[model samples]
Target chain A: MTRMFYSLLLLSSLALAEPGTVIRKTDLRDKPFLDAAVVGNVSSNTQVDIQSRKGAWMQVKLPSGQAGWIKLLNVRTSSGTTSSSTALANVIKTGSSGKTVTTGVKGLSAEEIQNARPNLAEVAKMSSYAANSADAQKTAQANQLIAVQVPAFANSTPTTAPGSNIYQERRR
Target chain B: MKKQFLLPFALAAAITASLSAPAHALDLGKLLSGDTLSKGLSVLSNAGEALNTSVKGLTPEQEEALGHNVMANLLGAAPLMNDAKVQRYVNQVGLWVAMQSEQPNLNWRFGVIDTPNINSFAAAGGYILITRGLWDRIRSEAELAAILGHEITHVTQKHHVKALISSKSQQAGSDLISIVADYNSSKSGAKAGEKGGKALSEIFVRGLDKNDEYVADVNGMVLAARAGYNPYALVSVLQLLGSVNASDSTVALLFSTHPSPQERLDNIDQVVGEKLEGYADATENTKRFNQVKR
Candidate 1:
């Protein structure tokens, strides 16, 4: 009776991670960029807690209480609980045989897509509703979207490593 | 690259195959004539038709025709959400990006399918659709642009048409299927029509070539940047997708049909690499996005 059990640890654990472990030798960088100086390195299967994500980078805290970024592909998350139980948890089944069946869940399930019959009228409508280039250009101008020149990945900014996997996929 | 033999090679094969028909014998009802006329003719005819479908080049006009049927089937699967405001907003964003694509002159239209799943489709002839679920997850106009840019890349690259034509499983006659009347008259053609429908469905279920997908990701980033959006916004959307577990029904089809989100993110990092830090303050257009979304 002298001590009370508080669920603070459990709450905090759930808040910090999906309980991830590194799958390869990974550098912990000061920032998400690969060119950022490596503050430390963690070996394969090293346990770490995932904190946040940016593009391919994940901000993670290591077992040693040090935190930095890791490539998202380098770590695997341990499953805690199944998020949804039903075949499609969010789907709203309006009717089985109805042509226009939609539930609150919103979109078609994979099964429905596989079984769908062609609707020519709808297809025609989709075709007729197209936006011309002038309309598109005006919309962009309204949104203040100024086109920028972006190089193809082959001609991308030079990377720190010459033969990195990042640039290899283009040729692959 | 797919092993797309030249038309002359296919024609040669077809001619050679037709010539090899059992021309040596003719029998009258002792079972020789029955096999020679009926089954033999059917096999040769099926082979010729199959070869025709295989080698036929889909011109830009024919590509649009193929997309029409595919779009019909997609609409049957999931109808567009019935909100004109949302639809127009999405179309505005989509059209802006489409103008920057390879097929900028092709009529471009975008729609939001009323499903709560993470999915998008690019029909040939410049039609793109995204599920409301994925739409809801987008936090900024730039993120929305990023998503549209990826889907639009599929159109610009002609990924769907190439996949549709090169698909060995679907009979080539399906490419010409315009009206139900095309499927109604002949028995063999009817069977081929059914196969064609199933093929369209299967194409949606599986996906385009893996390399095509990778290319879309790379090209999509470039297109987004060109449209005056933060190219990295796609990564934000990808991160959100990656955070969701595969068991979640929201991503059920997406995970099954796509390369894992992690690989896509990694590829993005590779393509953009160290260039990300410089665009950290790129325009996100949060106010406009919030106003148009929902």
Candidate 2:
């Protein structure tokens, strides 16, 4: 089963989907090393836009706009997510109108991107990205990671003494 | 036979000598009655009175002189008034009470004696001495007036003369009154015996008998009431004295000389009986005194 999974993962990487591949692991380390800082994690079968590739790593953009390099063999592509080529075409067509296009292939188009600002409205729209898109998954995963890592009350432990100097005087 | 005649003659001459001097050297204890003692006391009362009446007695100048001397001795004994206000307050109260007293004609000097003992005393002259400790404990001007009245009554009633007569008899039996007057009448002899006379005077002040004490208390209440003081001032002063323990020297002296506070208080109740209706309430005095700082 492991051999089959590895073969399928390699095949998906070579025949990258429109955005390249799907996330192969339910979680990924946020840092480069096995011991690197876990800034966030990803879920398996979650599709993300593969913006660029290096020797053994692919830099993918989650719908939440967080981009990081994951092992090439750890993700496969979905056909619908805009590939770098399509993103480049969209930008050039808009730029040909003598209007400013969005900066990168992986970045959003100027008009659509303006509407798809990464805030509450953009994130709530199901049509903005896949229903269970990698970006959404990563956002959810980041939240979960944060929930486990830091307590909501961590900041609530009184940063200032109750009643200020008056409390201190009473204490004395 | 001649030696026998000489012995009889010598014995007869000795008997004659004894008989000749017999009346002059009689024991005062044997000669004076308690009535005579009371009379002699009235005489001493007269001495204090003579300050007003007779020229031979203490003159205003002499009373002032005595007061100055007493005040000097007092200042030496206990320098008073760390606060000018307390001194002024005492003087004010004392002057007011003196105005109401029988001795209003004479200038009464008031003072605070710096002592921890709760004590107050008035001398034969119009010198009133109050101790700070007593002031600290008293609750009202009426109470202070009562204490002063009790002491002043001792002066006004001639308790000292009775005290002196008793003292003289106790010391010299019959010789005291007879020899003392002759000694006082002669300038040279009295001046010669003035040292001894002063010692007896000290005794008179200190050695008051129980009767003198009772008479003083009885008269003190009348005087205090006459002066518009609440009769209860006597009772309240006694109550304050009673609360202090016996080990307190001032309280002991006060209790020793004055009538038992409980009895005096009761006596006041009986004497002032129906008249209690008219006395002014000292509540204002009490309230003013309540926070008086020691």
Clash tally, candidates in order: 5, 10
Model 1: per-residue lDDT, tens digit, B59-148? 455445446556767888877866666777788788887767777777788888767777888876677889866765667887888888
TM-score, one value per model: 0.67, 0.44
- Native contacts present in each candidate (fraction): 0.44, 0.00
lDDT of each: 0.61, 0.43
TM-score: which candidate is best?
A: 1
Here, model 2's chain A TM-score works out at 0.32
iRMS values for every prediction: 8.1, 50.3
Q: After TM-score superposition, what is the CA distance of residue B137 in candidate 1 from its true location, in Å? A: 2.3
Shift in Å, residue B279, candidate 2: 0.3
Tens-digit per-residue lDDT, A66-165, candidate 1: 8899876677554323254432433333123232245555346678777887666766566556666677677777767787666666533222221233
Off by over 4 Å in 1: A1-82, A85-107, A124-129, A154-172, B1-57, B165-198, B275-280
Q: Say which candidate scores most in lDDT.
A: 1
Clashing residue pairs in candidate 2, if any? Answer: A20-A77, A21-A76, A21-A77, A22-A76, A22-A77, A63-A135, B27-B174, B28-B173, B28-B174, B41-B162
